[model samples]
Target: MNHGDTSRERGRRGATAHVDTFARDHLPPPDQWPGLDLDIPTPPGQPGPPGLRHPDRLNCADELLSGPPADRPVFLTPAGPAWTYGELRARVDRIAHLLTGDLGVVPGNRVLLRGPTTPWLAACWLAVLKAGAIAVTVLAQQRPHELATLCDIARVRHALCDVRAVDDLVRAEVPGLRITTYGGDAPDDLLNRPAPEGPYPAVDTAADDVALIAFTSGTTGRPKGCMHFHRDVLAIADTFSRHVLRPRPDDVFAGSPPLGFTFGLGGLVIFPLRAGASALLLEQATPRQLLPAIAEHRVSVLFTAPTAYRTMLDALDGHDVTSLRRCVSAGENLPAATWHAWHERTGLRVINGIGATELLHIFISAADEDIRPGTTGVPVPGWHARVQDEHGDPVPDGEPGLLAVRGPVGCRYLADPRQRVYVRDGWNITGDTYVREPDGYFRYVARADDMIISAGYNIAGPEVEDALLRHPDVVEAAVVGRADRARGQVVVAYAVLKEGAARDAEALRVFMKTELAPYKCPREIVFLDALPRTATGKLQRFRLRGPAYPGGDQQ
Candidate 1:
């Protein structure tokens, strides 16, 4: 397959092939894709998901950049630098021109994106979309084999990479992939060179054209690419950002999730741009660093996981976070204890959301008024979320069941048969356990795979983790099912303590007994310096499974 056009040939008027058959060739067979549930309404009786389909052709870059508030600032760096929509649009245009003229990128081609979250990376993503190529943005931390797997899976033949991390790129061993570095030798680097001068037209792409291939963080095994269309890309911004986040032009978005994660892409980029707001990008934001950065940048909207928020709570002393108006949590269950503490200290309600890479962004989320502190909130406008039993039938309210949702966006995996497991009977069954209230709020229980069935008493790991976190001594906690000959499985908890705090597993066990039901209390409490987590800050409970605990084993 011809991956992209030749530079000289592409430069000539009407000389380009205009289509990359390689990308088109790899799309999952039509029958394998989940039937889009665009007609579903939000929690019933509300209007159905709107703008479910766009007419003929529309490039996301053109629509988002040329929309209203084009002259307002849209991007900000930690060093106080900012880019208005007009400037960012110009840069995207120039980059798009360079992509086609110098790099030979054309419509339907696949462009591999790598690097930390930076303005240049963001621009490259938009530029790829603007040039009509599918952007396959992988995590910078991906090793050689992982990178190679994704490249081959997506048929990626070109890359815009950060050369500083050369180990993986050099070792990926993907044949025929021409790599272009961002910080290459003076004149050849894309980031260092000036964008070619010209008004490059954004590709006139079909609304259903695949725009991005965001690979999921596969905790179970190798990551699978979740293909998203140009229309689905904008659908998230319109539904979640518009209906739930309600970000304004004055809001300054901040977050720790890398743009490689769809969570960050929406929170830090798409949401802000769609609302005509600016975003503050932090390359290395830890608990110690994030608080000061938030105070320094005067960030208004913060998006991160529950773990980071808890850590930030620990490090909030001497930090002024009054500039923050909204805090969005996802990637894992948001414990009510953490939410209560943050609200107690900041007087601002944290907007919790449940989203996945497959859906593009958030589906269930609530902001200010509709928020129920302990729950994951209701479905974002344009979505329908329902709890279901093992049989895929809807379960009554208050019964913990698998979470099944459908909306304008749904799972559309790239060449992966796991699509059937995720989407059934027109519903995207996100592998999460939840219980809905009569009031329409959805409470997160645990990942369906993360549940611990000890002697037939079904237990949610997040519930036990939440109980563990309430104890003042526990800084971080993860609960998992450990194999047991007697009870089939037992709940084991791994915890991290505060600085200078001594390990007291027995005291934590006793404390947990008081807060939780007898069966729900963790059978084992293990003290570790830290719980394992993904680079995106999600707790890797799978890694903690079967760990021997130091105390509370009353066998």
Candidate 2:
């Protein structure tokens, strides 16, 4: 289990173990990268927090999975029985052998993983890292065009896909990419291939070596590749999971996010594995499926979005959910109403967090007694956060400004010029508009781009949407600014109503006038069956501002 070499041979800035250097070559210049506060020496004579401290020559996968007791269950799924740590290690070792021996995968090569959430898919991800390759994990349901774009950006050289999900990847037709399938009887299947047995030694990658490349979910425009190092993976588990979530070894983790999403990756895989706990890997975890699974499996920790929590509340009548002790909400703002409702019903505080793909995982969050219903909690123990203006100067409390963060983990876009925009003056400006209360809690405003300016007033879309969600008949809501000739823009709302509820836009507007300022009320309401969302379930606000509106594309 030891992942250390002599400091003289492999220090933090010493030679890397990678054979291929594509990831190292593609990293943004050191000056352009956000300040990584990983190993900076503490000021003379001052004590430091015991976080992010690891050997210079380390592989996170080796550290996470190598030392657990041989017979403890690490993964549980409805499709089959639990996978003990011994079984998982055997599978990962064999896969690692196949990766290096048969697949000709060298260190630093990028390996794409496309599959539903399952033990086999998780094993592939670990094998890629154990072999010193960069993992590019993506949604299995992504279309060919999206897959092609991602492969082109990451220059993926190999892929291990579930047999059911390999067609779109083959259709992507990425040149020079080798595809290997699993979960089938084919001679070329990854797990079925021959390999040396027992334990496979882990690659001695330097702490700063790129271990994975995560892409932004394309919520704004073209997705950007984010390069994360081996240490970054463990940093999230140490800072948030250790200091905040505090999971025990016996806890059973469950969640709705896919393993490809960083939220899902942390909640379902990294956190549980690091804590020596078991996670129930679900391929399809909607509200309907999650409720029953929680009751049946005695799940202690749950992770999902605000929308899912609200949906589950409606279906909670007959389900026995006392097994859940921790519920986390992210991927979007957790409206105060939803938080209060969930807390009242389950007697568990919903930990609200705000994170970005660029930062790897949740940077700001709260748990237990530290929970604040309406605000995203203070920065995790190892991180620092503040409200700052565009000039990178701190803003006063109670004023809305950009959320600036710097910690052991920060944004490092792979060869993208937007690096200059995301990291400025050593701080990762999260592009989130937030208000810092005098008491130190960070309040969610909206995405900086989602702010609506009408005439001379500034408004946050989430504020209006939160007000609309208070209506008993409203099931879902998304607010955006539509172009208007008089005011520069007008507030417009898209809402989904309950089955038996009236769909009168005017009546809803009248109700909103009572809850929000008149200017914040929706000028026009668009009724829809469901709000538009990306494959990852993030709301697509731009679609609501299309060319149909007057000032849609403002001058």
**Tens-digit per-residue lDDT, 146-258, candidate 1:** 89999888888889887776568879989999888885686878866766786778888877677889998866677888988787888898788877777888999988899
Instruction: Write down the lDDT of every candidate, Cα atoms only.
Output: 0.81, 0.88
Q: Per-residue alpha-carbon lDDT of model 2 for 366-410, expressed as tens digits?
A: 999889898999887777889999888899999999999888887
* Clashing pairs counted in every model: 0, 1
RMSD of 1: 6.3
Cα deviation of 355, candidate 1, in Å: 0.3
Candidate 1's C-alpha runs over 4 A off are 1-18, 22-24, 37-52, 68-71, 192-195, 546-555
Error of 1 at 140 (Å): 1.6
Worst window of 10 by summed lDDT in candidate 2: 1-10
- Model 2 ranges with Cα > 4 A deviation: 1-12, 39-51, 548-555
